[model samples]
Target: MDVPGPERRLAAVLAADMVGFSRLMEADETGTLARLKTHRIELIDPAIAKNRGRIIKTTGDGMLVEFHSIVDAVLCATEVQHRMMRRNSDVSPARWIQFRIGINLGDVIVEGDDIFGDGVNVAARLETLAEPGGICVSSAVRDQLGERLDGVEFEDIGEQIVKNIARPIRVFRVRLQQDARSPPDKMADTVAQIGRKPSIAVLPLVNMSGDQEQEFFADGLTEDVITELSRFHDLLVISRNSSFVYKGKAVKVQEVARELGVDYLLEGSVRKVGDRIRVTVQLIDAESDRHIWAERYDRKLEDVFAIQDEITCAIVATMAGRVEAATHDRAKRKPTDNMAAYECVLAAKVLHHRSAREDNAQALRLLDRALALDPNYAHAHAWKGCVLGQTWVYNWCEDRDATFQQVAAELETALALDDNDSDVHRILAAVNLNREDHDKAAYHQERALALNPNYDLIVVQQGELLTWLGLPEEGIDWIKKAMRLNPYHPERFWNHLGRACYCAEKYAEAAEAFSRITRPDHTHHAFLAATFAQMGSAVAAAAHAAEVVKREPGFTVATYLATQHYKREIDRRRHEAGLLKAGLPA
Candidate 1:
């Protein structure tokens, strides 16, 4: 009796090929072939057998394998990879036999111990996407083997438009353990990629001023120095949030270097007296824990900002000689003539970062005071707009329409005062996003990036903006770049990353991303709920849904969708469907 139709069943398909095999053979044909055969017989075959994966077929340099369990297939690939790494550890780089592997979980047509379908083609395409010694897997493979794969992390690489794939497939790079390799794809977007330029962190300057009220001045000086240092093309300045983690705590320079992953550390103290201001600064080699340079400046109070500029120029010249005129212009631009206004902005910035309602109110008041002192203060005006923009994000505004209008007005004034101010453009971009003005938002974002490419906040917002603009793949790259620039970035970065994951329809990755956030809010819980719902985990989805409602009782899918900034109607509909499945209020 003939079997009914062709046999079809879901299976894990793994495709792998040795990297540069042709070149290896061209260099040393006999030895290359012998080494390849020896590896297959000694390592690859045994690993496949142990993991219960069947070897379907093999070319001289590639193989297609099948497994009843996606987990087994992935495990086999990883085990083989580990053994290969150990075997090639002592081998010369030119003679190393690196393999790229790809796995997919899909329905396959079977006939007489052979299989063929889109599944195999997709796996082959994915194999080409991976690095010489890395693994790339389809989203389905990641979904099938979730957290069950211990010591492994599937970093979402976003939807890839591979050859012959009917649609873009969400792909993930499989990472084993803590050490991340510099694959070509990842290195392109990484700021700290292999052989980065000199990296430095400017620690918060200690306030040596007799009056406690002038502490803001000291903090402002540190921030200004950090900003000035960032303008230098050769220097990688750690973001303020990352550098300030050691504030008011006793710490060693080497410890800070280890924590922040920087090569240099700059420390200073600011002291103010009746008629004169004195500053002490020192640059330390973090790895050696030795002071490389030290300086002291005593200047009249009227020349405080100039003192900052001089100190910056000195540091830059010390770090890399021959500073450009444009660098001086960027480092020395005065925010406001009135020092009181500068202090007001510094105080408000601290409050703004807190993000609590009371803190927002305080920050708004300080920004108003700063603007009152100097109406043309572009930074103050920009921050005012940012505060208003946050009101919309955190649902703090009673009259959202009025708040949006006010935000637009403030940002416009800031732009008019100084178009080069990245913060002004960034705030305007956020305002445009809230108003659903996608093109304008993107334009402002591009301007922001142009003004300050290395600014962590601006860089990550580029990612967030792109994700909301229906280009999650590019957004993921930008966000990863931001992380690379600031290793100790704030927790909110993970939130943006998680949202990017969800936007790409990789729910398992999205849920894991949200879970890893240091502090999860209603939005985070809601995302987790939707992600779990997409994966058909009813219990997990219900639990996360409850968490969202528990945090905000009136939370509903409709309300949530209304607040989202997704440009495409289809994307919003997709998100809505997940929330609905999670039993969130419509």
Candidate 2:
């Protein structure tokens, strides 16, 4: 049954299906079907229209769509997912549904409205490879949109063999991040807006020190430098863990940039001999294959730690001052749901970061979906706990004690499933710190750091905890290190550094650090007031004290003290004296 006069040409095909449709139906078949129908009518259909997608055909739980533009096809898929997230927010996790999307740009034989042949099959196969609530695109789809997706990163998961396909397909997992150092978006107006940030990855230094014993030293040096480089507020630096994935393997810098979503690369080597050390470092523009900066350092190893510090300061001082401007363009914003339990968690993360009561509510709703989608997803459970903890932290919970208990239970589930996930351990660390369980907090913090030392949040949190633990000097150094790791970090980082500085009796330094905050809230003003008071500056202290009360009229030093969880009695007393001296109610 072949039709005559059929046209054949290149087109983009998008294949998508609801993940776990059968299980959802089994749980509540009739309700599930009705909800899915509503979703199709309200969300999916409209998005397809806006993106210029043609409806080809639909299976009971899946669909095949055709698009003239490859970019349209991919955008439609992400738009649909974004819409699904919004719709699912109103429902419970058990009723929430997610889709896995795959896209391929290849030639297809068109007969009437139906398309056939290798291209369609490739997209279908790609769909099966996508993490639920995630999209997978073939190399063809990726190649069609080049620099336009500069801010959008695709994690190359490598080649995969699919059914009914003779050749393996290279798959990339899309992940979204905002980097200020990246070039402007070059794609047409179809992609989402992620921050136009340029990113760089620093690879592990080769231990050219000849002695196998020096390998660890070389590795440590690389990590230290990465930590130092992360301080600039505008630059984006990939974590050391990600950069080290290519350790001992030769990789093209440009290829690495495409995979890591970084525009530049930093590679180096280290060698140490008797009382002497030599280091070589190069900064590369990955896209152009050009060396931006390269230097060799030769120093007598009078003090190993001192030499390392000197090198770190020299490099960070050089790079921190060189941030470039970037702009918005078409960006395929990748999502974050865990690899297996991808959908609900991805939506949850977006909601969680919205910093509002309603957004947190939506986040809880989506996280529930994540757990329903994959109850075995440890991160879902952990994130659920964190959300509950947030309710208490923000004073939104009806019963703080009950919320804390629930947080503990959820973390227990997370630890049981995968204690190795740095986030799980970090959340536990945060919760323990809140409960004043210093031992538990320290234990969890160490575990998290061990899991991913390059994680900026964990690194900064470690400093925060250390400062409270009466090691202000050490905490000051550590937090400063974290700032280098994430140059454009959140404002809270400076607050933590200021707190440590104030606690360590560095009054002027504390005021300077607090002053760096662009938007000072009541807490920032309160900290500044305390620092100024410590330095005996009556006018400056009084001004900040007045601002704090103006911003939070009911705030009192005692109330704030009760909320703080400083580990050392001495530090707490020191802070209280400063605040009280600055006219805060005792």
- Candidates in order, TM-scores: namely 0.46, 0.48
Residues 1-586, model 2: lDDT tens digits: 8776657889899999998899999999998897788567646886789789998999989999999998788778876765566445434677779999999998899888799988899999999998867888888878878767544567788999989898889987665332136544643221222233457788888988787866776788788877765643235789888988999888888899899998778888888878788988888877678776677889997877787777776565444433231111111133433222344554565566454678888889877876765575777888898888878787777888888899899987876555456778889999999989998799789867765665566888999999889998999988988887666565768889999999899999999899888867788899899899989898999999999999888988989988788988998999999999998877
| Per-residue lDDT of model 1, residues 127-246, tens digit only | 999987789999999988879977788889999998878899999999854246545553464423222345788899888887785577777777877876675434568989998888
| Candidate 2 steric clashes | 19
Name the regions of candidate 2 deviating beyond 4 angstroms. Answer: 1-373, 396-399
Write out the backbone clash pairs for model 1. Answer: none
Q: Residue 232 in model 1: shift from native, Å?
A: 9.2
Output the TM-score of candidate 2.
Answer: 0.48
Q: Model 2: how far is 544 from its true place, Å?
A: 2.2
Candidate with the greatest lDDT versus the true structure: 1
RMSD of each: 22.8, 18.7
